[model samples]
Target: MDRRRVIDLEEFADELRRDPHPVYARLRAQGPVHRVRLPGSDPDYATWLVVGYEEARAALADPRLAKDGHKIGATFLDEEMIGKHLLATDPPQHTRLRALVTRAFTMRRVERLRPRIQQITDDLLDEMLPRGRADLIEALAFPLPITVICELLGVPDMDRAEFRKMSTEVVAPTSSQSEYDAVVRLAEYLTGLIEDKRCSRPTDDLLSDLLRTTAEDGDRLSAQELRGMAYLLLIAGHETTVNLIGNGVHALLTHPDQLAALRADMSLLDGAVEEMLRYEGPVHSATFRYAAEPLEIAGTLIEQGDHLVVGLTASGRDGGRYDDPDRFDIRRDARGHLAFGHGIHFCLGAPLARLEGRTAVGTLLQRAPELALDGTPGEWLPGLLMRGMRSLPVRW
Candidate 1:
């Protein structure tokens, strides 16, 4: 009999936060799958982390790994607040939710925002560029997507400062009780916001559309589903893109060769954005997927009821999938990366995210030609879910 290896991620929380790829690389050397305990999780709970690219792709679409919150029982966050969204459900339900949201988040609709996205980018840079130095995360990364998503959803009165606090707590909770409290507060805020939207003047916003839109079969989002959808859109919309811009800029500025190449030839912007996503995507790992039944991944047996984490970051940097996986090369053939995930649960806001990333990075580089890291970034966000620095200080 062999003893199974246990990697306590909580033990190396700080190190992993700063640079998870190195740790994931070491784990990949061991095997494709490892049993690990995430930071802030209860001591006894463990999840299977799929680090290999092939394995991760398969695990993401594995039917045996269920996304239903009921399958995993009670969690740190309130079920009503987080459940019933696209990521938390499987098939039929997921299929339906995706369909409804997609109608509003269509690529055509996102494309229409190109002008607005560019304007926002220019306006933000206009304000920050004059200072010659600023925390890029604050000056650009965080606000860009939050502002876009809020307007898109018709959330006119949201308090970005306070909402950000609640959103951060919901995603990267410091404790179980803290997460519960945050979710409760967020749920209350969202509920109130939805009601306010209802009472206020009608507007041409996604949320307003969602309120009245229904399927051919007359399937419309329930009040709870509406809240769940709003929570997902608001948090995921801002959180993922913020990190994408922040992480993408950090990657390029650190890799002078890549940055220089991009600067010399603007044609590489698309590939650079793809490479940024592959190299350092916003979401490090997908949310929890519990085993619906006994399953095997990369030859490792996973018992029923066991939890699993699809390592989006690890999969992107899998040595087996790409040459020099750790090196940041904007020109690499970076297709097939699982940065936005795979199968039915692919990020609904991917188009908007890409639009924002391309506009922000391209415009920033064009405006601030001498942009460089001004100071060491603050600690990385604490959690396996979101991969981002707390703040990235930079100067032109």
Candidate 2:
């Protein structure tokens, strides 16, 4: 622990949130890992930000840096509001949870969902493209994945705008009380949904399958764990992809050359999405992980119990990892970018996200050849965990 040299990140919180690449560049120039105070962290709690590509990648998969906070006497909002789920567990617990969830989630792979994803994209475009001008985030990006995840989880149609409001608050709260209320509401809703599923005849939804799933040893997801899984899936499932689409489109709109290249030859659509993820990923940073025990990262000591936040956005733009890192090129070989992360905690929804992005961007370009930015993005989501626009205005 470097008690004498702690970089306070709250000092430039605004700049960091709006455009973090410059800040990441400055920090990466200094070293791979640094002890710092995040914008909204507890003042007394120590935290480190890993920025270098190699170090950030390694730290993500390091066993010493455990995902379970309870092991080190720490806790996060998710554990308190929901219950312990995949991200909040370690070892045997995590292994068991991942295995069970994987059984349910991966059964329907990305290829199987291609037609439906394309249909969803086309439907959304049909509604929005005719309007000529609209907020892309609200019109297409947000709804596509939310609809998919909700249907997968068997959530009945309700007030989507309200749900969006609640989910957004949980991820990027304006106040602690707001976040608490949002989490409570979500907890109540999921509890009711789970109970409804319990009472009703079994369905093919993931949540329903989870309720019925049992391990070889007869272990099953408790009610609390079920709710946790649902909450994680509902929130993380759509939110990350929301940004991937919003950010990817934003990158293209900002860089017309790349957009034109994609429009000229749709074959680059897949690679373009990869570059978009590399250039401006939806996940700004990996969720908070604690050092289970003392560890060394890039020659710096990360004391036991200290928190680590690997800068996914920073690593994506690492000059050492890519030539002309800051330049956005659809043709770049962005195969190893940490956009979806790497390791046990790697996003299970990567294939789904890629499918959605490819379909969404490809279909939109095919339908709206004259699409152009109507105005600047409304406002970046207010958090380091998620990087997305609240509203992306566009005209076609």
Candidate 3:
């Protein structure tokens, strides 16, 4: 049998930074699973690309699959920087860590924040209205969710800017030695913060809840684990929502009819957000996973220890699944979309993300009815992991 062709990760990364759907279509046409060499890695390091909807979902749901980034020697940060966080663990361990925080991310907890989220959205827009022209990302998309997460996590108001900077550097598509250093620094800062929170009395916030939580055996998260969890939640919780709001707004502005329909009826808010997630999710690829044992997906065989990259963005747009998959329609039933991922590892923050998206986009439309893109939508962030514009200059 012929070995699957390698995808040029550098070229693919360039496409991802700009626009990747066309390239995704080409890869998807090849097969359900394609072998590819990741750029900046060893020549022998071949990873499986799961791009189709069914195959991506299957890979995510497969129990034999592992989310431990260390398994395949994939390290965005040094070993000291990782510290066995939920994103770096496989089942059993991942299950335990996730369960500890699941209640905090429940729909009820998210629903209770609707009023606060709306207030934050309104306040940000209030500040931007006078500017006439502002970068939606800086003024609204980025700060709104960061503020919300800080409030939810009980992070000190004064520390938010530092946290935001650290989070951005850690997750930016382009990472260098300095960026890895930033991750270490951020981890150290979070370790201190968690220690501080532990020493203080509990408060009415997620961090406080986490601090108070213990396993059935009376075991609580270690300092390292707590720091890791805090880092993951802070970054994932805010950054993804920022893109959802930013990307969703950009999508609407680019599609006038859809924007008009949404403005004409507020009931479409839920559907519109779903479409936004499906059309352009924050994470282009799901968090990296590895095959624990040999597995076969859609007739393609994957060996144990092989790296797997599930293309959430590509799978959402698979033509076989959605009619006119390229077109963005708020009316479409996008429930099956894998934007938040699938199975046991699906995003725990989906409710919060949706609430933020609706509050941000819905409020923007109501406030600036004549909102239009201020600059050419030519510049986008570069990365295979994330898909979003670097900045959205807009005017009322």
Cα lDDT of model 3 by residue, 1-396, tens digit: 145567667656666667889988998888777888765557777788788998888888887888875676666463467577776787788888888877566688889999999998999989999989999998999999999988898888756666667676666636587578778787777778888898898899898888888767786777777777888788899989988988999999999999999999989999999999999888888877888788888877788887888999999899889889999999999888998888888888888998899889988999999999998764776556666777899999
Output the TM-score of candidate 2. Answer: 0.97
The lDDT values for all models are 0.88, 0.88, 0.83
How much lDDT does candidate 1 score?
A: 0.88
Q: Clashes in model 2: which pairs?
A: none
RMSD of 1: 1.6
Mark the 10 consecutive residues where model 2 has the least summed lDDT: 104-113
Estimate candidate 3's RMSD in Å.
1.9
Which stretches in model 1 have alpha-carbon errors above 4 Å? 1-4, 72-76
Q: Which segments of candidate 2 are over 4 A away from where they belong?
A: 107-109
Over 70-162, each residue of candidate 1 has an lDDT whose tens digit, in order, gives 876735355665557888888878889888877767788888889998998899999999999999999999999999999899887667888
Q: What is the TM-score of each candidate against the true structure?
A: 0.96, 0.97, 0.95
Best by lDDT: 2
Which portions of model 3 miss their true places by more than 4 Å?
A: 69-79, 159-162
